[model samples]
Target: MPGSPAQAPAEPSAAVRSAAAAAWWTRWWVRVLAIFVASRVVTTVILLIFAANQGQNPWTGPKPDYFSFATIWDGLWYNIIAVSGYPSTLPTDGGHVTENAWAFMPVYPGVVNAVMFVTRLSWAPASVLVSVACGAGAALVFHRLLRRVGLSESTALFAIVLFCVAPVSPLFQVSYAESLGILLLAVALLLLVERRYGWLFPVTLVMAFTRPSGLAFALALGLHVIYRWVRRGTDPFPVRERVLSVSLTVFSGLAGLAWPAIAGLVTGSWTAYTDTELAWRAAYIGYVHLVPFAPWFQGAQWWSTVMLGIPGWVGIVALVVIVALYAVLLFSPPVRRLGPDLLFWVIAYSVYLFAVFFPQSSTFRLLLPLFPLLGVLALPRSRVYRVLMVVLFLAMQVGWIAICWGVAGADWSPP
Candidate 1:
């Protein structure tokens, strides 16, 4: 009876497992990465459901048929260039085609075309695959770069979450240049930190080629290298590194100034989106007398009216905090070791966006990639603020998902 009474062993408790899971969540970055992965899954699910409901082929159909190269905005244009082979001139058919001011940026289209040439996959799948690769790459690169810049592992993860969950982040994974641009920016920052001035030059070339805004980074980085040369009084870097840096300096600056000219040369007019400031004029204000015709000064028209409200006030507060943090970071000893690479990129990115883009749209999709950089530069040591940043980005991602889902049902028909 005593032996019989000795029952089988009790199962292991989930409480211990739960405790371990809780600890895992507290690590900050793991939590942030989890959130990001989940958001993407959620959005992808919605897209799948949308495709199924519409009887659209997730594998193949019309342009954005199920979910391929076809995207709204510039994505459609690039897909066209990729599929049909780059046409020297778009087949407009005299008001038959629908194009937008934001539709042009030769680097992105050119790269997609290059991919098509090698892979020979039809435009749709190749474009989608490349987008996914670049987006994931950008996120991974940003995570590492932030870690190097003195961010806590949790803070860096949060930074990744911020990028992935931001309203514009989906584009990083979709058919857009932002994903590639972010990757390049992160790589450039890493090279800059290593003081591989020579290597930086080629990286600079890629940056300039990817986005016109890259020219600013090129100037800042080139100047830094030149200043280093003056300080060392002897060539400080390895010969190869010097070659890349010098070459990049030329490409970044020369290529930067060349885009508009190229566009004008192609279109027979300077009114191409890259060349024409009036292409999609919205919030811009002429600055002939002041800060010059920069995007932010121009973009002031967007928030100027909105700022008259409460939400605008919040943005104003956020802007002030960002600026103040930038100033403190300039002097903070803890981050002093990271040096100027990060600071220069932040300034260059912000300045270029403010100087170039318009005022109509508030989220400034063109500059959304800069948020992670902003978060890195402004990452507070406080636990509370870190949590807030994670929460804020999650909310933004959710909002964006909602907006995109709403668009799915529309006949916006991919170009």
Candidate 2:
């Protein structure tokens, strides 16, 4: 009996437990974390440099002691609304600017104001809190998505870092809608992974209401679901799922349109922003023709004034690159084994971004949800495919940073 049934060893000791926890930090993920931190620091430096070069603005400028500068143009107005709720509009052309119509969607500012009321924190600290919390949420979203895609913990950490600290990701770390938008986006992605299409609507509705960018995302996801169903010749979703998904997506689309629509009504018209655009959006149509191709414009223009923009040639190259790469990513082997389930969200995201072509909206920001779409192209099994992925990874990080500090989100004008 003694020879046949020796007892198993006891549980790990307290010291061993501590040692194992310490060892966990030494995993491959630790390297990824280190690289991510380095990337963030570099991006932060770039933001400071950009702020320093801005000459001066009495309202907003670099910190006096070089503490660090963050927040972009739209961030200021969002902060204003947070500090003091939207002032009663006095009527400009349509509704009054004081109505906060031009500031941004209400959700982020509402949070800012709520925090001020409850915690009695100032705008500066509150803004920082918004940014940090949202940034962490975005990181978690990427981590979950990467895990869903079967990436190792280390690679997932790298991607999460890119999403969190990379230059393009500053929006997540500021008082802007980017961070909140990211959290909802992550929740939506997780729901999608769980096949919880029912959540897509409410989540997307909140997202759409929170940020106009969310509308674009909602539309993209909606179309993707519809397209898959159409392709299958049978309803790709169960009857209840189909009804709920479509209904929610429809609601989201309308919710995005509602604020503008209501703003129009309040102003005794239905297109205040469009009117604002008409006064300044002359070349917008011509610009859309450049879509799915290259952005030929040198700098994005507002009020007939142009600023530096992404090279049209670069846009052309990036377009080709997006297509050629995603082509391979779309039909890879291991992923192919997972079939439609694997690509559902990616396809949805791509369709959403593709659904819009205008310059007035944040279609590019919508691309954040499409990160996985971009990752799809990197899914193949090959040396060349793998190398291309490395290049793409580095390029995305650099490109994001350029957009944040260098390109200046190109679309937004400072409040």
The list of candidate 1 runs beyond 4 A from truth reads 1-39, 46-70, 84-103, 110-121, 152-154, 226-247, 270-277, 282-291, 294-298, 302-338, 371-388, 401-415
After the best TM-score superposition of candidate 2, give how far the Cα of residue 213 lies from its true spot, in angstroms: 4.0
lDDT of 1: 0.58
Each candidate structure's count of clashing pairs:
15, 2
RMSD of each: 9.1, 7.1
Q: lDDT for each of the candidates?
A: 0.58, 0.56
TM-score of each: 0.67, 0.68
Q: Candidate 1's residue-wise lDDT over 1-415, tens digit each?
A: 7667678988768998898888987874455556556767765764555444442333345434545523644566566655553334533435322244334455666776778789986656666667666766666767777777677776676566667666556665566677677777778777777676666666666666676655677666666666666766574665666676677667677767665666566666554534234433421332222244444433343365444544444555665676678667655664544456666665566666656555443244666645545544345667778668767765665565445432443322221
